[model samples]
Target: MSESLTIVGIAGSLRAQSYNRQLLAAAGELLPNDVRFILADISNVPLYNEDLESALPEAVVTLKQTVESADGVIFATPEYNGSIPGVLKNVIDWLTRPRGQSSLNGKPAGIIGGTTGMFGAVNAQMHLRHILPLLNMYVIPQPLVLISQIQNKLDAAGHLTDETSQKFLQQHLDRLVSVARRMKNEQ
Candidate 1:
């Protein structure tokens, strides 16, 4: 609470105009003025290769430091074949890292997503809820935001335009920041 809270967002999809990416891009607008939202870049990260961890790629190091520094993380994922995207999973693998120490350990995380499908990305979010805890992250359990039929919600420029969805996303970010603040204060 004493310092400005920094919450980072990582979109699992690499497509420039993907719904998840647009959602993450618009997250800052819905957050409190004091809270900072950073959209993490995962494009340069190579596929998960254990052989490369000994020296860690430059992009990997950058991402690890970014995640380690933030008070909280929001994973905007797109469900691919009923599960989380491989790119996002690859990034997590990088974060879990060299040993018992992980950047994600004990950090607060929130899951959110949008999709054209009727069910949204619920399966992806659920998968993340189960996986993140194993790495020691605190995943937010309430006020789920599974935005379905995202094409109708975002404008041509990819910004979220629906007032109702805006309010909901705002609430979700607020809660994520609340949990992050609590954890930081406790520490």
Candidate 2:
């Protein structure tokens, strides 16, 4: 690994006070202090289009570069209806185009999510798990972090106040980082 291990965290929500964004922040805090954790900004990426393929937007270019340089990614997706949010899916679409030039290709990835619903974004996470491979990412299978009825678990400041949720999130991050380390070493 290039002297330091790096992980990029992407929250699937655009809302400033989004629970998913808080979840991503918690993941960042749970990680080892030495790890270089980045909260990826997806706010500026325009919608994907074939017509715009030849001239990729600056935000897309930066997003791709961020993911392409990282050892692993953590996606904190919020469920919409019974599926992943369109914004998250839109970001994935932007990363996956131009044929074989995807920044996410073969990158180690982990999914974490929370929702006000009872299912804790499980359905959305399942959908996202299925979609990762399409972007050529390898989803980490163990220690899944799914937060259902997330409001009860977070404090006003957005930190996870529930022990159970914190434990699960920590375990998931540990596993993700371990896998990332292995991948980086192999490179």
Candidate 3:
């Protein structure tokens, strides 16, 4: 049998009770046995700075290494002022630095979002879809997940409790795994 596919998952929210983080946790539980989803900790990643890029802070180095080692990436984000949160953008800046040789180059990426608002995180996901291509990432085209009313989908413990939401999340994971597998072979 072929080796299991590894995906590095990043939650774009730092709040202790963030719905985006809860969505990521649900995704981790729903991934298939052939796919491994590991959540990358973004809590320690410092704000991006050109001077720090020379030495590359430990957290930044770790984030890059985690992304580079994974077959694909899954971003669970929240919209902030109609775009990605500042912390998430900071991490992306660090990952895309040095111009041409970004760690995310040519890698397949799946983006999903959870928000309390009725629009979910549609704007943020749309913006990321445009930005990722510039970073050389092959963003998946299908099974886009924008979880609205997220507070009702998961429990206080961060587990997915809604049947409909679980099914939707599973579908997203399936698509991500399939696309990542195909991209892996293409590379």
Clashing pairs in 2: none
- Compare the candidates by lDDT and give the number of the best one: 1
How does model 2 score by TM-score?
Answer: 0.96
- TM-scores for all predictions: 0.96, 0.96, 0.94
List residue ranges in candidate 2 displaced over 4 A: 1-3
Model 3 residue runs over 4 Å out of place are none
For every model in order, what is the number of clashing pairs?
0, 0, 0
Tell me the tens digit of each residue's lDDT in model 2 across 1-187.
2356789999999999999999988888998877888999999998888888899999999999999889999999999989998899999988888777888988889899999978889999999889897777889886778888999999999999989889988888888888888877887
Model 2: which ten-residue window has the lowest total lDDT?
1-10
lDDT of 3 by residue, 40-137 (tens): 98899999888876688998888899999999998988999999989998889989875664989888888988888888799999989998998988
Error of 3 at 67 (Å): 0.5
Which candidate would rank higher by lDDT, 1 or 2?
1
Per-residue lDDT of 120 in model 1: 77
State the C-alpha lDDT per candidate: 0.89, 0.89, 0.85
